[model samples]
Target: MIFQPTYLDLLLSGDLKKRAADFQRRLKACDLCPRDCGVNRVEGEIGFCGVGNQVWVNSYGLHFGEEDPLRGWQGSGTIFFSGCNLSCLYCQNAEISQKVSGSEISVEVLANVMLELENRGAHNINLVSPTHVIAQIIKAIYIAAQRGLKLPIVYNTGGYDSIHTLKMLDGIIDIYMPDMKYSEPEISGRLSGVPDYPSVNQIAVKEMFRQVGNLVMSTQGIAERGLLVRHLVLPGGLAGSKTVLEFIAKEISRNTYLNIMDQYRPAYLAGRHSEINRRITSDEYQVVVKEALRLGLNRLDKC
Candidate 1:
């Protein structure tokens, strides 16, 4: 089946532009993420994410390191947005997320980047760490769609999202790839600096699933639309992988495309915490994977 991007329909209906404008207006108060920073980003007021009106892009290119469905044969077109709403203590991409290293560009240039990635034969436009920059991204998508950018958009988030902002993105985004960081609020707060992560993340995931149901793939195995959940297996069960898996199986969907990642290593300030000071053991990874399977989550990513 030929897959058309959801944003194209919104663009035709003129809702895309309206939504873009509303999202742009949000930058004034900047309640884009769960942070509710309320800083006037339009007037160059830096919020928790440290970004203003202009979109700051760390890098843009085809990335094959993503999930199989997203990467496919052509690779997923990734735009790594600098700065993040949640500060994960063990974040591997600390240079970009925490320090916010990138060049600021106009919405037109951001749109052009999307077009360039599509021209390079990317399966989808994956916006990495996008929760804080929703307004900027929405405006860029509006411009990109006007300039003939038709690739499926992937909202690759850290899961600490605002339902209001996500409601604005209902039909605009195609694939919703979010990380289910922790099932415990205390663990999340201690590790990611977000005390309300569990509740916020769960709500965001449910909203994402409501927008786009289960994973839909093309004959060539590229994701067209879906909610793909990622849970990095942390050392000493700090991630609460079992409970998270159960939630996915019960609340989300038993067939949810889950990536039980084993790539957790002590990066950033992880060494400060004894429990998360080292890489996850092979046994630890297996335990989580076993629980996921036990929960009847069949669509586990073969990584």
Candidate 2:
């Protein structure tokens, strides 16, 4: 059977638009994320993410660099949102996430970008770094759905999301692909500047799994709806890979689709830190893979 996006139903019932307005209103205080910046984003007040009322998009296109399920035959329609809620010291896309390197666009333009990607044969609309600009994304998705956009919406977040915000996005988002960056609060605070990342990320992931049980796919092997987690293996067990996989197996689901990422090259301010300055060895990646299998996490993503 072919997959139908859930947001289209919300659009038809006009609930999507209402949710958009409700989300936009939160921008007044801007407690959208865990930071609770409290900045008046509706009145163009910039906060920790450095984004204001207008939506800034670094770029949008059909990208094949994502997971195989997301990319499919054509590609994952990726909209790289400019700005981030977390300040990771080793961010790979710091140019887009840290520094404002994209052009600002209105809701109409953002909607058009989604439609254009669908025209290009994209399997899904992947919103990257979406935690900070969720209100804007909801507005654009509503507009896109009204204009014949019918692809699954992927919330590609950094795992530092607020449960309240995720609650607002319950039916709108089809795919929840979040990164479980770290397992220790102190490590997260020192590396990513988020002191409560361990607790916050765990709660956020649990909520995401509750919304979409496990990663589901169509006959064509394209992702339909569900949760696809990413865990980057930090050197010297800094990411606590064993603990994370155990949580997935015990708390979440053994069928949870997980990607134990082996790509942890030191970037941005990583070189400043002695422990994370170097890249992970082949053995390090293999160790995490073994732990995942041992923990009964059989649905590991293919590298």
Candidate 3:
């Protein structure tokens, strides 16, 4: 066996306090995510993500709705944070995404949540919508390390990320789960209110793949370390699934683990937008899956 857990080993064997302090400094003038709002979140300035310095988690529990590998038997210790960087019109979790529902937590309380999940046999600590609150998450990781949190950390994001921000999570995060929303800029702009999301997401996914390559699963099928790309097939070619598959096969690694999702339905402002007003058709999803397989990406899940 290896000497200590990989991420926890790095933390315990090094001075995490220094890392935490350095990360906290970035919050002063937060360019933490790609949004680069340049607002001082530590000074209580809310930026594009509608969040401040403190991490606002909506829920902390075992989640089985994730991919089979991620969920496994027990479940992933999922901590869903409120306020998203990308305001997708069809955001399923509109309640938590648009409004802060949980109590404001300190690094200590956040650390406890990590341990609580570990005690309950969670495979990993999954941080959902973590782009804006990366600093606090790192600080919490440092604290949790001291208290013996050994499971791998998953950086679950909406794919609008800053490369500089991801650099800080170099040795901390083991799994990078990001959504590749749209392949066309106009579609992204119209749906998520973010222009040039296709190109922006490409850069971000490249950085994630650079950090972690293809998914390396344990004997039990739990992902140990890797980059997992999730793409939700939107209605009326908004997501451009064929192009996305081609990009993964050509630009990103062909062996990259992907989830070809088919669970898209009208939500949030989807009903307001004509292009995204309808649910994804079975044929549309089939075309995307066929393209993925043709591109040699065989690893996929319906959920």
Candidate 4:
């Protein structure tokens, strides 16, 4: 790889190891995400995310369904961590996220998965739903970096992250692909079970942009580093898509790489909320995209 991942520098300087150890220690109380579930994860006590000390992985493989830059010809290496900080009413991946259906594995196995994906020619290691397991992921990254894992680490999240956790990952993660789910706190509360999602997500997204700036791609069109935001348009304007786009364009960056997703279908508990129990129309999708462009956010990803 021409573009070396930033974690290697940390690994060489021994900071990666230190961070890993620090994260491991935090498991005693486990305040990693915004939920602040102070359960003793090290003692196998499940918290709000239904996660314990060990890393729970549902699956791992090359995923082409990601944004174009992240998924090139080789595909993005996705390690689907099975648990989440938020319980979205319309959760698309409810089977895994809500139920927490995955096997608990050691950090060594997670590191091996990273190395295996790297050897398989994956362009990047994508950590799906990783907010709850940041400490374990960092520990695994430290291990994998020592074992010749060179691909950029993609921190794919739902944007309900804590500032403390994001601050700890300043130089470790390369690509920060986070979802700006909602702008209205009430909508977020009703749909996602997080009343403060708007405030928390906005702050987390801004921090992600600050950490990595705009998306950068290699000559081969594969993402090397930086922040990529995804905003899924919900039916009937429930997601407050316009205000969410406005935040990205104004508060974050006009040059920010954004994906205005339209593939929102009623899934999981979405049927309960009648307003969001249908797919978004083409007009609904296009209007948000046009508004984003009008706001001068031209770096749109055709996902």
Q: Rank the candidates by lDDT, best first.
A: 2, 1, 4, 3
The 0-to-1 C-alpha lDDT of every candidate, in the order given, reads 0.91, 0.92, 0.85, 0.90
lDDT digits (tens) for residues 1-303 of candidate 2:
767888888888989999999999999999999999999988889999999998899999999999999998899999999999899999988999998778999988999999999999999999999999999999989988988999999999999999999999999999999999888889999989998998999999999999988999998899989999999999888998888888888989999999999989999999999999999999999989998898888888884
Give the per-residue lDDT of model 4 (tens digit) for 32-110.
Answer: 9988888899999989999898878999999999888888998899999998889898899999999777788999999
Candidate 1: clashing pairs of residues: none
lDDT comparing candidate 3 with the true structure: 0.85
Q: Using Cα atoms with residue i matched to residue i, what is each candidate's TM-score against the true structure?
A: 0.98, 0.99, 0.96, 0.98
Q: Per-residue lDDT for 1-303 in model 1, tens only?
A: 688988999999999999999998889998999899999998999988888888789999999999899899989999999999988989989999998688988988999999999999999999999888888888999999998998999999899999999999999999999999899999999888899999999999999999999999988888999899999999999999988998999999998999999988899998888888999889999988888888888899994
Better of 3 and 4 by TM-score: 4
What number of backbone clashes does candidate 3 have, counting pairs of residues 3 or more apart or in separate chains? 0
Candidate 2 backbone clash number: 0
Candidate 2: residue 233 Cα off by (Å): 0.4
Instruction: In model 2, state the lDDT of residue 171.
Output: 91
After best superposition, candidate 3 residue 123: deviation in angstroms?
0.5
Better of 2 and 4 by lDDT: 2
Estimate candidate 4's RMSD in Å.
Answer: 1.1
